[model samples]
Target: MESLIDKDRIQVKFSAENQFAAIEMAAKPLWEQGYVDEGFLAAVMERERNFPTGLPTRVGVALPHTEAKYVIKEGISILTLDKPVLFAGMGNPKEKVLVEILFLLAIKNPAKQLGVLQTIITIIQNEMVLKKIKGAKDPKTIYNLINQFI
Candidate 1:
């Protein structure tokens, strides 16, 4: 399995206007690389609206995704915003979260979702990993930090 921090899918932006804008902007590189389909951006936005993936922690993170078919490739793409973006809460409907790190995953295998989720969970559970990801200054640093998991 390859790490998600591929050159084509990484974006380093200071801020995003809103959640939809953030997702669309981050998904562009993947779309351009043919890792995602034409409808993937819309689908991911819709899925996020319907079923939020926001996880509240010391350092809040969001795992935005849709079905596997939307992805033409199997990898993870990471986007870190200097300012946080708002995403609806996963366990709570009324609550909203400020997500600093967005793990935009493109997995073609539905069966791998569980393992991917597990890996994400484990990584986030560690305060150090979360801190490292949050403190990473560049895409390559973030990529190197996450590659340790694989």
Candidate 2:
């Protein structure tokens, strides 16, 4: 779980002007920890522009990620915002969603990305888990919830 979810890297009640800043905020720790390259943030921003990762799940989350080229190590950066941020819905440019959670993925292995994403999707789709996340007051609680699932 340390490799996937760095407890210290988790952000609770995170604030940002927009999704791009939120992504930069989320990716900072991973970058400082040597998990991702300098290009990680830029690549993610470009990817989001061309193809949004926002999901209209039970909790309204976004899964922003880029190619393995931007990754030095595999990890997931979770940010639970203080307020919901609007993001273009995935595969639906016309639609917009207020996302409270962001999962910024930095995966060095392309083959493992799908499985990891699927696991996260499964977690996000679970009503109980979504409830727990939305109700969580701090990073420890959120981290604990993920630990339970993982």
Candidate 3:
């Protein structure tokens, strides 16, 4: 299996309009690297708009993602926004969240999808991991920390 992260896909944006913009920005590196199709970015955004992937952490954070087909490569793209962005809540649709860290996952295989999700779940469950990610100052730092876990 490919590693959960592709350092090439990591991005650090100081200004993002919203969560959708963040996801699109994060996915750009992957798209340019030829790891994802041209349509993958748009597809992911559409899927998310219709079916949100926000997962509320026990300590307060959300992990959002969509289907594996949106992936051009079997890797993760991470973004640390200068400001939080609102995303539809996972556990409660009525609620909204300002997610600081967005993990844009791209997994091509359907069978491997569960494994990727499990790995992400395990990583986020660790308070230290979440804290480190939240504390990360740049794309490299975030990429390094995620590499340690997956």
Put down candidate 2 lDDT per residue, 1-150, tens digits, no spaces: 446987777888878899888889989888999999888899999999999988988778999999998888788888888888989999897789888898899887777887788788878989788778867878788888887767
| Residue 98 displacement in candidate 1 (angstroms) | 1.0
Q: Which residue runs does candidate 2 get wrong by more than 4 Å? A: none
At residue 30, candidate 3 shows an lDDT of 73
Whole-model Cα lDDT of every candidate shown, in order? 0.80, 0.86, 0.71
Higher-TM-score candidate among 1 and 3?
1
For model 1 the TM-score comes to: 0.91
Better of 1 and 2 by TM-score: 2
Model 1 Cα lDDT, one tens digit per residue, 19-115 = 8877877787888787889988899999998999788877878889999878888767777788888888898856888888788888888788778
Per-model TM-score versus the true fold = 0.91, 0.94, 0.85
Residue 65's C-alpha lDDT in candidate 2? 94
Candidate 3 displacement at residue 146 in angstroms: 2.2
Question: Model 3: runs farther than 4 Å from truth?
Answer: 58-70
Q: In candidate 1, how many Å is residue 140 off? A: 1.3
- Can you list the residue pairs that collide in candidate 2? none
Give the worst 10-residue stretch by lDDT in candidate 1: 1-10
Candidate 2 is scored at a TM of 0.94
Clashes of 2: 0
